[model samples]
Target: MLTCAVPTTLGPVIGAEQGHVRAFKGVPFAMARRFAKATPPLAWTEPRRCTDYGPYAPQPGQLDQPEDSCLSLNIWTPVGADGPLPVLFFIHGGAFVTGGGADYDGTFLAAHGPAVIVTINYRLGPLGFLQLHRHGLSEADNLAISDALAALDWVHANIANFGGDPDQVTLSGQSAGASMVIALATLPQARGKFTRALALSAPGRNIMSADHADHIARRVLAELEIEQDPSAIASVPLPNLFAAVERVGRRIADETEAGTVFGPVLDGSVIPREPRDVFADGTLRDVELWLGSCRDEMVMFLKSTPPAAMIRTSERNLRVAFGDAGWERLLACYRGSVRPDENPYEALLSDAFWHRPMADLARSHAEAGGAVWLSRFDHRPALEPFLSQGPTHGADNACLWAHLPDFIDRPILKRKGGPMMPADIDVAARFQTSLLRFVTSGMPDVAEAWPRFEPHRESLAIFGQPFQVVPLNEGARSRLWAELSA
Candidate 1:
């Protein structure tokens, strides 16, 4: 029973270090009301017991209890750390609609310490990113983004007593969480909150203007049959609100150019401008960045989508993205040739939606004289059939944090061949080492294999069995996409 009372500005917190790592779960970082900016947690006298995970914000298919004041965080620290450790503060990904800090178990990542890992939960879905200011609800919009900023503020103020160095915080996330890291990095308020960031498979195109946010909010109100009395939405039952959010999200996703719904809105406040503009203007000049996408970023989505539907969906998406003639030109570029089993539609979709955008962000950061390291995660798990494919979107996450709770569909370290493969151990070790290295230090120490991302010399680290740093010009699909875009 390793128990200690750590003093914070808020109060004393009691946490325990167990077998694998010491964890302090359900630590309230902030208190927030619906549609309002988050505030710091009220001071407490007694040492708050942080044994169980906190409630996740209300969203669809969440097994845990729903709560509005869901601005809590979970901290995992090394069992025996003498000095203040570097901090890895992670935000989760679920397209900004679903997922919580507790969704990721930081035990594995924390075990590689002398470093502390913190995961956070914020509001999701319409309750999160929808800007309701136009509906006469005058409150801070971008609630989810605000929640993230508040979480960082809390960490900066209180992480030192938890054996974490407030000055060496590394903000990290996957997908929407990655997007949040980018958004937060842009804000001046976040300037000194963290020293560095690592974004995994960031959804670069999800941000929308305030008008688009209002459009989604109106759609959700209509779906709930309360567009005429929008204020009633605040009092609607949680399940009803969830259903309305889903219906509106699906509708907007089908009809909108951005192709997604409910994300950080450019309200000229929280997110003053698009992330691209911020990056271009050197907003994140001080923060060291390690950002990358998986090799088959869109494969996970395509796995469930039928083959025929994949083709049709790709065409539809292209038509929506580019006009008729442009779509045809782009499609023709992809039709050149591919592997026997490779679907050109899937390849093009990956490029247009994820890969190109990720690379573009890297380019923009590099162009603005920011210190950035780019990577492509190509590590495939040792599956039974052994498909000659790259790692799917967010697959590196499972490998990176292998000590997470057992997910039914995603069994950790177990390929169909059964048992943890030696390759799995090697890959996990490399990933863990690289991640810890980057967190503790500013640059990734990938056995001296990776190079800093420079505009003229664009080399990307490839995380596979035989890890190597390859020039970005070596990838054929990326070349084709660049030519087509030009």
Candidate 2:
């Protein structure tokens, strides 16, 4: 590892180890503007401070309402950048609503291994996604993707100065953030920018359609009372425009009963194609991949939704997502005998969506001769109310980052051994240990040989304490997928 400087572009940026962790705040990767719509990025001059993570674009009405704007990046180079280290860049997820680089602190992540950890912020909701208003740059990138690309470019061009390997960069995201990882891989622009990717609890494409994105965009516009259409609304003041967006968001949460369906548009140029299509081809062949999902993913989201509602909704979504075939296959997989009263919905949610697709992704990649790794988040929820939503989304939030939740000491995940301590040490440790190995050597630390997934062997590494291979349920999930894809 070569220790290099953090570039002159960010003049005298902060964050030198200082005993615990070296944190730099307000690092600007791209100059931001609240342009009309579809606005393109303009570069900034003057030495910008790379010393900290910057302010969150704006998010008040989303889940967990984001406690603060520590919207900053805390670099944990345990040993300082004296030696070049593999970098792990994290993208926090809040269902594309609320969350910023502020959610995570790199200190704990740095202790797990010899890696440089960087967390970043991107525009969310109306600011980041809303498809209808592009303020007018025809060929500029999708706003959210552009933000990610800008950050990647920043890391590539400048990480060397921070004693980090720009070439060995691994981008990891959760939920919608995970979708970003997958999207980034398929993006023509992200080619070779990152060496590896880790996507957890995410879906690759819109299960919905253009009409859906359009409908939502239009609805928000209308609610903003911005009398004009999407194009016309462009002239509205940024604050007014955003106010309308928030109104629609509140309506989505409080008014309408519509299920959330935010995702990247199948925009022909920037996205090119859905990540599934891209992966099917050879777009991400050169990149090492790791995919994971919790044992009860639906439960994670369910923690917010009522338990009964969780089961009811999962059942309904299964029908909607997989349709008739999915419903039938699910019946067969768990058998019609599942405890009617027990609400086996969470387990099925995990298996059908996250677990199943992730496995399928591994098989498809390996069949195409790509290197891929797989795992499951088996940690259970400690609280009874949370137990039903076993290891919910962002469950790994605590373990991946440290000193992050000051007063929110314990995460939802429960340990089998006792209270406060997670019942699943194995799951977190395996994830931590293997990630360190993967970042350093470009290969994961695993039991036996880390074999590429194949149709027959279906070699996927389960990420409990002692990582090992787990068989994939192709037959059942295959039938369900056929329905889902249909």
Identify the candidate with maximal lDDT.
1
* Superposition error at 275 for model 1 (Å): 1.4
Name every residue pair that clashes in candidate 1: none
Per-residue error at 315 for model 2, in Å? 4.7
- The candidate maximizing TM-score is 1
Per-residue lDDT of candidate 2, residues 1-486 (tens digit)? 222335434443445454544555556566554321222233444444455455665664332322133223445566543467889988877777666775666666675566788877776765567665343422343567667777887788877666678888998888888888888888878877788988877853323344555667768767766545446554565556556765665445433223443566666656767777677776677888888776556754555633423345446666776577757767666654354433355556656556767877777777777788776665553434444555566565544442322213322122222233443444555566777787777577644656656666766665545556666654554555565666
Clashes of 2: 27
Q: RMSD of each candidate? A: 3.4, 5.4
Error of 1 at 340 (Å): 4.2
Superposed model 2: Cα runs more than 4 Å off = 1-5, 18-21, 35-53, 62-74, 80-82, 133-141, 204-211, 227-261, 305-329, 332-342, 381-388, 402-426, 447-450, 465-467, 474-486
Whole-model lDDT values for every prediction? 0.76, 0.61
